[model samples]
Target: MTSRSEILREKMEELIAVGALAPGQHLDETELAARFGVSRTPIRETLIQLASMGLVVMRPRRGALVAELGPHQLVEMFEVMSELEATCSRLAARRMTPADHVRLLAAHLACREARDASDPDAYYYKNEAFHEAIYAGSHNQFLLEQTRNLYRRLRPYRRLQLRVRDRVGASYEEHDGLVQAILAGDGDRAEQLTRSHVMIQGQRFADLMASLPQLAAGELLAPGAAGRTRREGAPAP
Candidate 1:
């Protein structure tokens, strides 16, 4: 069962994704508590959770606000996420046990089902499971935790990527290749395939930009826009 904090976080994320809460909008604890029929305690906790996910920014005196990453910042995040995922895949190829293989295969199968059903939301959840399997198969606790952290931070943008034309189908094919490489215990191939699968570059990045105009009536920042800077204290890795 989902905790109160988790439910509140999900609702807040939906609001942001649907543009009901624009970027940099202040999150009033009292209002959210009333909206969710909970006390301010859970709302406070939920803001902290969202802050850790990079979806909310908590300033020293400004309280909590929705995070708004500029295009360059978003790309920087994707680059780091790509490397983390590639590392996980490489280690997974070397360390995955029989049970790990079974779990990963199951997740892939579920992703296939979601794709075939043409449900982007369902596919998005399954895609998360598929990556989680890879992270677990790495068998490195620190790496798994770190990758999961970055993965959570990138979740919203990753979901948006699926809205790109034919992206879900292409992503499924990439997963097939990754699974085959990992099953063969080919760490090099697994690293390469996973990197390509996760990295938003060239045509894929362009396609993502093209799809964003429909997201919020030009509210989303375009690449090369002025005043775009990386998040303070965010690691460049």
Candidate 2:
């Protein structure tokens, strides 16, 4: 069952990821309470929850502000994430069961369906699942937990990647290749593909950086922008 606190937390995370709440924006408890039609108690709890997610920074006496790990810090985190997920892909190639192979292919197809619909938001959710399938297939509980933690920390940054031109289609293509390599039990190829898929550079990195100013100037969000913030298959906020 969904609780009010959980919904509020998800809403706040969505807003932060979609750029509706800019980096370093102050989160006033009373205002958030009014905004969600809840008491300040849940609002405080939600902010604390987001803090744990690396989405909010709570100050001792002054409430909270959105966490602002700038581009450099984010890049550093991506470097770690790249290595971890690459290891997962490599292990998955060797250790994955037949069931794991089936799940991975199913996730790939789901990504294609989302791409065909031209739904970037839908693609985003499926994309997470696609990567998670590989993580689960790795059969290493400790590594899986570490990878997922970093991935959760970087969720807001992925919203930037999804906006890059042709990225969703390009990402699907990358996933196709990765899936092939893994299913063929090519551990080296799977590791290499996973690294490239997670780490951005050259033109794609430039596109992501360029999108930021546009996001700040209020240009990148399309009509019905709230949908980007909602969880997949949930009603639009």
On lDDT, the candidate that comes out on top is: 2
lDDT digits (tens) for residues 1-237 of candidate 1: 756566567677655644455566788989888877899998889889888778799988878987877778878988998999999999999999999999999999999999999977567778888998899899998988899778766655776788787999999999999999999999999999998999988998888777655544424323332122222212222
lDDT of each: 0.78, 0.81
Error of 1 at 79 (Å): 0.9
- Model 1 per-residue lDDT at 99: 96
Tens-place lDDT digits, model 2, residues 85-179: 99999999999999999988988999999999998877887888888889999999999888987786777577678877799999999999999
- List residue ranges in candidate 1 displaced over 4 A: 1-22, 60-62, 213-237
Could you tell me every candidate's TM-score relative to the true structure? 0.82, 0.87
lDDT of 1: 0.78
Backbone clashes per model, in order?
A: 0, 0
Per-residue lDDT, model 2, residue 152, is: 68
